[model samples]
Target: MAMSRQDSRLRYRAVARLHAENIDQGFLPILGQDFLALLYQAIDESPDSALILAEEEGQVCGFIAGALDLKPVYRGLLRRWPALFLSLAPSLLIPTRLWRIIEIVRYSRKAGKGEAVESLPAAELLSVAVAPSCRGRGHAEALYIELARFFIERDQEAFKIVVGSELEHAHRFYRRMGAEPRAEIAVHGGTPSTAYVQQCADIHVSR
Candidate 1:
């Protein structure tokens, strides 16, 4: 059955809420639900990006967001900058939030210059989250497999996942998915993160 426009909107909104509630370490979550919904919608709409979700009984149980080339995703967001800026206005007023945003921009510049870490693929796994109630299920793994298929279909050989060092559970999850830590880096100064690289060739998508 084809999904209606209203169902698609609800899924995006659910994705935003799940991200904020589950992805606590990221600066994007601090920007709040409205911004996240818009961002995910953009990712779904962008040719360079992909957003995949696991739904059970019409509820979003998990979701993964990624891009083969971030430039297009960035362009998509920038094209809608006015609404995104307005959505982020309240968070921008907070000094800590503003500083994080600046840190993110600086990190992006460094990454562009190859100063952030060793050479890595242009394709990236931006964010993945599964709701707590749905944790024991295979939702996370299924979403990841689907994302790997997404990259593979795009001819992306490899992809990277940047996760907070403090997130041991996340590290374990990635490890289980056959990703290996490639480098230690910080998106925000002093806060450590591990960049994990996953080779798409190794993924077996039973289709």
Candidate 2:
């Protein structure tokens, strides 16, 4: 049991580093690796969320995090608020960073209230990324498929993903994976993000 926990922690650290280095457009990476690691740990432990990884010879090459219901994921994080707060405290000292956090929270709250043009599934793909060296490989798609399997096994029919409008490569990737753009909104004040929905009803998962 101790070894399993240790291995999980190590995986979290590796993916956190990968996320910070590759998913540069996000607000969470700015909080540093410790915060990101803790966040991934929470996702792994949360019943409503999942953290899936693609490893190469035991090294984490890519990862994806998602929740069947984000409210429960938020509750899981709140349960670990003390540790999360400790990890986030230093960033709070930066006014801009603090505001960005507030913006994220407000955005989440608004989305929770059904502010979208059409209602989206409660299940959502929170984050996905692959290391720069592994980009041409299919690790990203594999991780995504695994997460879709996670949701499908839980009876979730569809899942949503939000990508920054300027990330053309990411947009293309999701579209290729059969996710259709459903709406656009800004999580931060001026940064527009497009939300895409992937229906799992027709997706065939071989693994």
Candidate 3:
């Protein structure tokens, strides 16, 4: 149990680091201990959340975050950690990209231009990223394989990823992984984006 707990933290830290520098981080930097605390709540406190990390030479190179049921997990986070979020309020004043935390949440809540969230009881791929230096090494695929297995074992059955349209590389990656566009949505500042869903059958990852 202790080892499992430590591994979770390690994975969280790795993903957090990658997210901070993600191409879309411009939308929501989420920097600092406050945001890290929020991540802990999301990934650790949320029973339906899953994270998988890829390592190289004992250091994290990439990771992916997913949720079996995001609405409940988010609701629980807000209810159980009001104080933590409240404490993070003042950080909004910082010039970093933290301010978008509010905007991003609002932007994502609006149903995409052509898709509805009710189409399926599918797991969500919250985020996935790999260090620039580690790209093209198959780390991303490994992480997704782990995530696929995680979802399958839990009976989540299907997974979806909401991402920006400008991220052409990532979109292509998901397409190659067998994701199909389900809807288009508006993001922070009314920018266009899309949501893609992949069934467990569509993706094949070696066990």
TM-scores of the models, in the order given: 0.89, 0.90, 0.76
- What is the descending TM-score order? 2, 1, 3
In candidate 1, the residue pairs with backbone N, CA or C atoms under 3 Å apart (3 or more residues apart, or in different chains) clash, namely: none
Give all candidate RMSDs, comma-separated: 2.5, 2.5, 3.9
Runs of candidate 3 with Cα error greater than 4 angstroms are: 4-11, 30-34, 75-87, 94-115, 204-207
Off by over 4 Å in 2: 1-3, 112-118, 203-207
After superposing all C-alphas onto the true structure, candidate 3 shows an RMSD in angstroms of 3.9
Q: Is 1 or 3 the stronger prediction by lDDT?
A: 1
Q: Write the per-residue lDDT of candidate 2 for residues 79-127, one digit (tens) a residue.
A: 8899889989998999999999888777666664556634887788999
For model 1, state the Cα shift of residue 129 in Å. Answer: 0.9
lDDT of each: 0.83, 0.83, 0.70
TM-score, structure 2 vs. true: 0.90
Query: Candidate 1 at 85: error in angstroms?
Result: 2.7
- Write down the lDDT that model 2 would get: 0.83
